[model samples]
Target chain A: MNLERLGRTAPAVPLLVLGLVCLIFPLLVLLHISLQVRGGYGLGNFIDVFSSGVDRAALGNSLQFALWQAGLCVVLGTPIALALVRLKGRARGVVMSFINVASSFGGPGLAFAFMLLIGTTGVLTTIWSQLFGQAEFPSLGSMIGLNAIMLYVHLPLYLMLSLPSYALLRNEWREAARMSGAGFWRFWRQVGLPTLAPFALGNGLQIFMWSMGAYAIPYVVTTSPASIDLISIEIGRDLESSVFGVERAATLSVILMLLAIAMMWIYRTLQRRGERIL
Target chain B: MSAQTVAPLASTGTTTSNDEADSFLGRWGALILLIGFLGIPLLALLVFSVATAWSGTVLPSGYTAEHWIGALTSSDVLSAVGRSLFLAVAVCVINWILVIPAAYVSVVVEPRIRPWFQALAVVPFALPWIVIAAGMQLTVKEIAPGLFGTVGLLVLTLSGVTFPYLYWAVENSLITNNAKQLSEAARMSGASLPRTLLQVIVPAIRTGVMSGSLLTAASVFGEFPITMTLIGGGYETLPLWTLRMFSGRVPGAGAELAAVSFATFALLFAVSLLITRIDTATKPADPVRPPARIS
Candidate 1:
């Protein structure tokens, strides 16, 4: 397959163009515009990220929302991952398929499905009002409902990512802990959590990244111009509806890309540590 | 939900007569949770879609099939569905032309450039769609402002956004199946480059590429942010259309939304089933990394 000997160019040219358009060129645009602040090329755009109240709040809110979602997924998904590890054969298949279907619901579609359960005058709201006579049910489009949707869509992913760590937890360790007169609480507290902590942290960090970058759900749910609370929504607003314009959005995108890279590095380090401990 | 509570109870099971029940609960807790999560919402959506009117009640006033019929027959639903289908198919076809050759060149024609292509392939995993969309919009708008909102641009951009899936999938297949060796073998007998790729290496990795394309189609089918950002105007896809009806506070939109959800979910379920069936029979153990993050 020596194309050079055959007097032909490698078909890498189109690949290069695709790369330029998709990654290289776009990043260049972001870099170029991010430098085009009101006065000229300086840290003005970067400063605005912190000095401007709305921009600062968007960054902070993205952090808060991502942290809460990732933290909850780890807490709620660990047992499911453990149970998945214990179950075997056809039963495992059935359960895994259920997880698969749920995971496939992904972002916006899952948000739509959950709307019936949590929207204003949603079925669950109606049922809750009838049962408790409260006559009020906060909709899923709110901050509370955002958490619920993130958890629902992400918990299954957590289970999948964490299952391998469960496999690292050998049954013989449990047997040894039991033979030493340790109760399950003592075993898990002293042995299990310590062993699985790094992987859980790693998995949680990945979810945090996903949640922080999430735009479609927040976009679909919010009817307003732009967000003062979320990075993705604010980026969108800057591009579409806000007077802040595409330059501001470009700056935010650059910042987000750097943050994502930093988070990924930390996750890789934690995953390495987890594997080593195992 | 803590390991403390669930574990201690299971510990007591080893010495107690209620061991059977405790162990059953311990082993099946996830299944029970999933049933509650996946099952309840689906049933609720189904009932609500078919229900005549369900405001402020645990149950609908009455059940009917009119909404489902309406959704299937409605021009809006049909057009949206048709548009999404066209986009997904267009994405699949475009990636086949773009990715397969690039993968072939990297794996067989020239191995030295593999690193660059590999690096670019993994970019989307860390890159947010909005970030990419912004950059892409700037790039496309700068290049050809008229093409900014066209379906052609969407097909290209989506092919970029979901590029990693097809790239990695086919790349893995080529590497594993030893396409370099196979291509060299074909060339030794005087086969042309096209002939070798079309006859030898392509057949070997056809299943891998096809399934990758199907999975790509699945992603495009549900894609929102890029489509919304790039072509939010002069277009109507299922996600956009459904969002419009819901967000506009369009009266009587519930039953209609449910009908669309039910239909969309059913189609999605079949595609997933097909993907799983193909993957199990063909795909090797996946790389240690998880699949693409939820889009």
Candidate 2:
């Protein structure tokens, strides 16, 4: 009877349908597969994932990797973001463009680049060996090295995300602090760090989730599946090995999803607090 | 007069010195960190690409263009590049087609139910890629075994994986640009809903659509695990091909790895440059007002 109501309903219905078919349906399918272990419906796969030593190790490795990656990103990215917001003109533009490129510079391409730069017989490694009289440079394939690569990929992202908080730190507040006889360190302690704490925490959690879910970089850098036992890598290995196969992979996927959702919830809460502080 | 100005002049001098020191630390210190952390590895990749032999030395012993020539001329490399490009373009087109209308409907037509739709859209980002891949694989196997290991399935998986990028970008653009007002104005002039959307809303948010498309393209170009696990049977995208090269399958193909990295860098650089150019060109013309809540 009403043209306006009809017009609105027409577009809304199709969008709702598409979202259901594409997004909601697949995730439901994933849940279904996770439930269907050994041609039956049960929580056996999840129990197996938690009870097994190797699977539990993979989960632990992923958590540790995520925590270290987030910590390192915050340590390295904050000063860079603070410095960036203080800049003006062409310099700011150039540095920002570089950060943009770096933030988007992950995936297999970045893995290859790092491999060429620091792998065994790599340029930097070769130089270190020759100069120091060592046979080989420290391997970039270890947990430490993997964390370093993850840091390089994630630092720019954290910096970019945290720039708004830095920008919100008005120069007037610093001037007022100085006028009140506060020194640099005191001002930073009293004003700067407190204001940025929520933002830093939020950014750290975002980076944590990102590193937890990363698949390509670790896949390319490590020589073997067991070399790095991240959940993502474990999922891939399970799918490939045919020992645990799709059901185990699906079970692991559900676990990863639950962890991510939990982390995302924390991140959102911190972000809201940060916004309120600003 | 000189004696009177001395007091203020001394204050100004001290302030200038302090300002200079601060600028130095901010500029040069930040630059050095960025170069050390981000730039040096890329520079090394470039050098390695041209090296005649770089083993056990800081620098390449000699340089040649042979690797570049061979990498470019190889049919396998070319086909891999072609497939990646084709996939990226197809993904971009599909995303735009799907996202534009959906963003429009949610943001303008039925803002009441936007959150429900938005939540669904963001599910891909919230869930791990492995889960999505595993789900799609099992579902596809059951539904259409014929489509398994086909490029078409890969495209579908990618569209689902990468749809959130475009959806959020376009949705933000629509909201910020006040698309609903423009649509209402068009409709008041006797234009139908579809006509108003096509002419008014689409033109208003063209830059956002382009940005989202380019970002989606860049992302799909670098995608590895999905392409490898799902479609590695018959399809080899650039990233997968690069992986094969690094696995020591191709003899003397170290330079090819370097070349692929550079090419990926080049593509990412171009996409970023275009995004910046669009941002700058559009920024001054449209001073953003805080958008009114739609519903």
Instruction: Specify the highest-TM-score model's number.
Output: 2
**Residue by residue across A99-195, what tens digits does model 1's lDDT show?**
6556646544566667767666677877777778766544555667677776766787778778767788987787667656666667789999999
lDDT of each: 0.75, 0.74
Model 2 C-alpha lDDT per residue in residues B1-295, reported as the tens digit of each score = 1112122333432444343366557656866887688888778778888989876567788999888888889898899889999998998887777778878887887776678766776566666566677667767777888987898888877876777777777887898798888888898899987788788888998888877777788778777777877887378888888778777777887787887777677767767777767766565232221110000
Question: Each candidate's DockQ score against the native complex?
Answer: 0.43, 0.42
RMSD, candidate 2, Å: 5.0
**Model 1 stretches astray by more than 4 angstroms:** A1-9, A90-98, A104-109, A164-192, A224-228, B1-24, B108-110, B292-295
TM-score of each: 0.88, 0.90
lDDT of residue B166 for candidate 1: 82
Please give, for residues A125-233, the per-residue lDDT of candidate 2 as tens digits: 7677777866554455568878877776788778777876678898877666655556556667889899999988988887787788777778767666436678888
Would you list the clashing residue pairs of candidate 1? Answer: none
Which pairs clash in the backbone of model 2?
Answer: none
Give DockQ: model 2: 0.42
**Angstrom error at residue A102, model 1:** 3.2
